[model samples]
Target: MDDAYDELLLRGRVYGADHEDPGPRPGRAYRELVGGPLDGLLLDVTGWDAEALATGAALSTHLGRHGGEGRSHYEPRPTDPRRWDWTADTP
Candidate 1:
């Protein structure tokens, strides 16, 4: 998995699962990149829930990289979704 994606998963483990229909959280970072103020914007997940988006954005910002700049670098190698263990039988 990409480093950033791994990092996100780690954060998710530490934080929590993303809420369904993340909404404007992803778009907020996109807008910042579109405005050209974000020279190194990276979007790890093109589509993510609000919680995931918020967590990613906060981490990226603190790391001093634009939220969009790391998208391509990390998204291609997504963490094994199965690792999340969200199965119907799990409950």
Candidate 2:
């Protein structure tokens, strides 16, 4: 819980677990470091670098557009973004 636990706590306290902000979620690095389903799903976004930010953006967009739309996770789909409430419905 050392990695960004403070951030999560703050979010939970302030946002009450319903808020969906892409800034605080644990990245692939933490997941991989621990090794689990979380390793995936999330891209390794340790530092606030450009690549990490891009990866996060791609992850959010992909999850929202493709995953949210219920498209096959097998075949890659284009990122057709729409204004969806990720706070209530996360992909």
Candidate 3:
């Protein structure tokens, strides 16, 4: 499985299983990516510190360098809560 799917399982978030819409576990917070390669993917920020949460993270993606792989950089939007805006892609 890919990193994202693996992460979901690791977070105990099962889709189409016992619960129809098993959202993020209680106490788990997430930020949704608004654009770029990983758009619409929910980023779990349950335990992220203030600095890290504000700076966002470099997420992995399968679309870069001849369509092999790459990393997408995102940062929290100034006016949006629990949302990250795509900045750019990196090799």
Candidate 4:
């Protein structure tokens, strides 16, 4: 499981699951690195204080990373985060 996903859950920030369709990804995966695990990160900071959210919402080429699947007691999780990112992000 990706640490980012766990961190999101720990803070109760994740809102819902949005999985990528199955397919081959060209170049770098937008949500996850090529073949990276996680359908993609979907953490919402809408409940967070303005300061906290703004700090993480910076504009940068290195902003996107891998995450999406949950690994809690009943959360939907993939076998690996590295491979999960390989799936298509959209249909």
The CA lDDT of each predicted structure is: 0.30, 0.28, 0.69, 0.30
TM-score of each: 0.19, 0.19, 0.68, 0.21
Clash pairs detected, candidate 1:
22-50, 41-68, 41-69, 42-67, 42-68, 42-69, 42-70, 43-68, 43-71
Better by lDDT, candidate 2 or 1: 1
Give candidate 1 misplaced runs (Cα > 4 Å): 1-39, 57-91
Cα-lDDT of candidate 2? 0.28
CA RMSD, predictions in order = 15.9, 12.9, 9.0, 15.6
lDDT of 2 by residue, 34-85 (tens): 1121222322334556443333332223333445443212111124111111
User: Model 3 segments beyond 4 Å from truth?
Assistant: 1-23, 64-68
Please, what are the lDDT tens digits per residue for candidate 1 over residues 1-91? 4677444433331211245533234232231121122232333344677555433332222222334332211211134321221111100
Span of ten consecutive residues with least summed lDDT in model 4: 68-77
**Compared with the true structure, what per-residue lDDT tens digits does model 3 show for residues 13-75?**
321234576456555567777788767667778788999998998877666332446788889
Q: How many clashes show up in model 4?
A: 8
User: Which candidate ranks first by lDDT, i.e. highest?
Assistant: 3
For model 4, what is the alpha-carbon lDDT of residue 70? 24
Best by TM-score: 3
Q: Residue 78 deviation, candidate 4, in Å?
A: 31
- Which 10-residue window in model 3 sums to the lowest lDDT? 9-18
Q: In angstroms, what RMSD does candidate 2 have relative to the true structure?
A: 12.9
